[model samples]
Target: MADLDHSSDDTSVDSREESSQDSKLEFSEDEETLVALMYNLIGERWSLIAGRIPGRTAEEIEKYWTSRYSTVSE
Candidate 1:
């Protein structure tokens, strides 16, 4: 009775939902500065920082920091 093999339709729908949530990040100069400041203050506590920045998810902030800055020193 369990005939639910991985359906392409389900995959496509899930992908669409994820893509919608992960929209392009349009961070202003102030936001970048704030992120840097917040990182320096809290140190990797992304969720707390994201709370201060409107419309930004913790994942986005982490991704931006990783892409822009080197974490080799830490």
Candidate 2:
């Protein structure tokens, strides 16, 4: 029989990819507000939010937040 030891790893990879795809646009007001509140409460700790919201990759949130910060700083 074939081994299925890599199943979990494959699922994780697929989830990450789906998150990346979902990050292309702005999230709804509810989601954005919730994520922002959570970010303020946790500060640079996105894995927590990621756990609650499916397809919300940490990279996308970090990038969007950084971009907003940079724009404001300029």
Candidate 3:
């Protein structure tokens, strides 16, 4: 109760760099190229690429490409 005066106003920040310990990368240049090639080769059948690339889902890949198109057009 005695130190309650400064308790609310005291600010502390813990800073630490966050590094991803992920073994798999989401989108590398090579992966992008391969995804594109797979898309063309399969034509909307993203499962082919998703199956080859670990930790990648066909739905997420499609969403990413769709978002890219929207961003580029805008």
Candidate 4:
């Protein structure tokens, strides 16, 4: 019988799952509206827009916008 090593593959899959879970943040309707307003006013300057949103970073805001609103708006 031959044994195959799958520990490395399992670790990589777990890390990817963790990252995906971390990225799945939820925004309230008010927050979404505010983000949309800021996006419309300032364009894609995520850093600048992030300042207006409390508890959210530029990267998070940018990711959310790109994933949720970019296609809809365009």
Candidate 5:
């Protein structure tokens, strides 16, 4: 455990900011379903998807969808 350095090594940020960032990264069930529906409709238009779901960015949405759906070859 002494070798691990998960916390800030040199910089510090407010807890509220950390929590808000954490919240943005998390995807609730409803959000997931919405992402799926929107994906079916728009087909990888990440900016549009992010527009439908506030607080989430296209980059994160793309990352989440790929992570959730990716397997073996894809």
Candidate 6:
């Protein structure tokens, strides 16, 4: 019987994380307002809300929202 390799490649994951870490997104005042409004209206559906923003991704938005709002709410 031949052995199948089940190990997962983590290089892509590491590269993605590294890229995201390196690329810091600066949200404008308008973008901040939009994100807040959309978050309030949609409630944590970051991907859907991200579509409304031009240069932002769901992960970035989610991270931003969490860092900015999560602690204040608690």
Ten residues in a row with the worst lDDT in model 6?
1-10
Candidates 3 and 5: which is better by TM-score?
A: 5
- TM-score of every model? 0.63, 0.56, 0.53, 0.63, 0.65, 0.64
Instruction: Name the better of 2 and 4 by TM-score.
Output: 4
Clashing residue pairs found in predicted model 5? none
lDDT of 3 by residue, 1-74 (tens): 75775564453211111222122334788778877888778877767778877778877677656654455642
Clashing pairs in 2: none
Alpha carbon RMSD to native, model 4? 4.7
Q: Candidate 5: where is the Cα deviation over 4 Å?
A: 1-25
Mark the regions of model 2 whose C-alpha exceeds 4 Å error after superposition: 1-23
Residue 20 of model 6, lDDT score: 75
Query: How much is 48 displaced in model 5, in angstroms?
Result: 0.3
How well does candidate 1 score on lDDT at residue 21? 50
The residue pairs found clashing in candidate 4 are none
lDDT of 6: 0.81
Highest TM-score scorer? 5
User: For model 3, how big is the CA root-mean-square deviation?
Assistant: 8.1
CA displacement after TM-score superposition, residue 50 of candidate 6 (Å): 0.5
Which runs in model 4 stand beyond 4 Å of their true positions? 1-24, 72-74
Best by lDDT: 1
lDDT of 5 at 29: 95
Local distance difference test values of all predictions, in order: 0.83, 0.72, 0.63, 0.80, 0.82, 0.81
Higher-scoring candidate on TM-score, 4 or 5: 5
Alpha-carbon deviation at 64 in model 6, angstroms: 0.4
Error in Å for residue 6 of model 1 = 13
